[model samples]
Target: MKIEIWSDVMCPFCYIGKRNFEAALAKFPDRDDIEVEWKSFRLDPAMPEVPRYQENMYQFVAARKGISYDQSVAMHEQVARMAENAGLDYQFDKMLVTNSLKAHRIIQMAKTKGLGEKAEERLFYAYFTEGKNLSDDAVLTELGISIGLTATEVKEALTNPVFQHQVEADGAEASRLGAKGVPFFVIDRKYAIAGAQPGTEILKVLQTAYAEWKKDNPGLIHVRQGNTCAPGNDCTN
Candidate 1:
């Protein structure tokens, strides 16, 4: 089974959706054979590249939304609590409200080299956990190196904009799929689940996909499915 997920690091639900999808994958009978890809989505195309201070950003965005700063904090608090349940901590305090187009370009490059997932993991954890600047070449290089990519390869990948067209192509594809949000998951390029659904919901989708795959590959042994899981347990559909 091939699962392609479109998500943005800045979106809190993307992290939760990742955990949900992982849970589903853990339960698949053919877990070892499953292929997963993370696609980039920019929630705010016009966003800046610098880090955003919590207080100021909260006030600025909330005022534009006609809500108080406290309301924004409350919303962030809700997402933070959800993240905790998912075994992840989002330091929104350290987040930079920046444009993600360049980040998407890097991901498109990583995909060609079969290092897309590693690069994405690094980018997400760095942004939501360590408060790193995504626009920094040094940080992006470190991310690439952490994924076993050579330093020169990483630098060349970022500097040359080789994947610029690829990123745009992905955006165009997303548009064709009617994707309007991050954390949109497409299974076998047939089924799509939008937003961060719960673990059970994701697992069911995986199970459905597995059934479809079995019809095409008759002899493929499916992974043993377990009892339906809640949030924490792995999903094997």
Candidate 2:
């Protein structure tokens, strides 16, 4: 089964989704048969690179959501606690707010180089936790190299704008499909699951999707070398 996920690195719920989905896969007996692909989505494509003071970021979100500052603070704390419970140290206040269009492109490049999952995680960590500027091509190249791809290769790919169009196309398709928000999952391009749903919920979806795929393939599995990078899945698939 191939699961395609559309999410933005800066979206807190996307980080939660990643953890929840991973936890679900950990409990599966046939985890190795699944292939997960990270699709590009931008939460704030118009945002510019800037050092955001913690309070300002919250204010920005609150203003956009038309919520009270107090409610925004509460939401921040809630997300922080949830992230902590999932073994992620979220530093929302220290985060650097920036556009993610190029970052999504970098993730696409990483996918071509077989570092898609790591790039996905690293991008989330860099944006929401480490306070890195996702809009910066230089920073993205460096991060890609750190994950496995060569820095020169990353630079070349970024300069050539190889995956930028594809990333934008993914976002367009998601919007065309009526996706208002992200952390959305399309299992085998049939079943759709939205938001940072619970691990058990994810498990149910995976099981159902895997069963459906099995029914069609009839005892065949999709396991291949370098399929999807996780704890056990081959990345070649």
Candidate 3:
């Protein structure tokens, strides 16, 4: 079972969707056979590396959506409650409204070394909970190092144009998949679930997709029965 998820680090629901998917996978019977890949999706590709204004997320949202600051705060409060339910701490007040391109670049690099999940998890926590700046090289380096990536690797990811190209490629792929937003999940390229759905919903899609995948890629079957010891030395007939 292969699951590809498209998400942005700064998206609050993307973090929540990650938690929900994890909870679902934990209960899945074939969890050991699952392969998860995190893909990059930029919510605001043209956003400056540093915000021109010293506004928090609430203010930024208000300005972007033409809503009042109080309304934006209220909306964020609702999202914070959702995060709380997902066992996350979202401090919108402290969140920086800046570009996530650098963070995505590091994640793209981490994917080559099989540390993609760790990179996504750490980035989400840093941005949403700790209110760290994803656009900062120092912050990204610290977070990447904490997730088993070397400082040199982090620096390379930040400075290299190849990583930026990789991020753009991922976005292009997402567009081809008809994804309009973050937290989009594609299972085996057969089924897709959009938005931050509940664990039960995601698990249902996983089960259905796995069943179909098993049918298409079934291995050989035993012609004769034999008593043998399994890998752990447990004998079964």
State TM-scores per candidate.
0.85, 0.86, 0.91
TM-score leaderboard ranking: 3, 2, 1
Q: Candidate 2's residue-wise lDDT over 48-91, tens digit each?
A: 66534433668777887899978988999999999988889998
List candidate 3 stretches off by more than 4 Å: 52-55, 220-237
Error of 1 at 146 (Å): 1.6
Error of 2 at 75 (Å): 1.6
Q: Report the C-alpha lDDT of model 1 over 1-237, residue by residue, as the tens digit.
A: 788888887677987888877877777667787788888777777766754543354665676678888998898788889989988988877776666766676677778789888777777888788877777778777777787777787666666755766666666788789898878998898899999898888888888887898798888764666767678886655
Return the number of clashes found in candidate 3: 0
For all candidates in order, the CA lDDT equals: 0.77, 0.83, 0.91
Q: How accurate locally is residue 109 in candidate 1, as Cα lDDT from 0 to 100?
A: 74
Full-model lDDT, candidate 3: 0.91
Q: Against the correct fold, how does model 3 do in TM-score?
A: 0.91
TM for candidate 1 is 0.85
Residue 172 lDDT (model 1) = 71
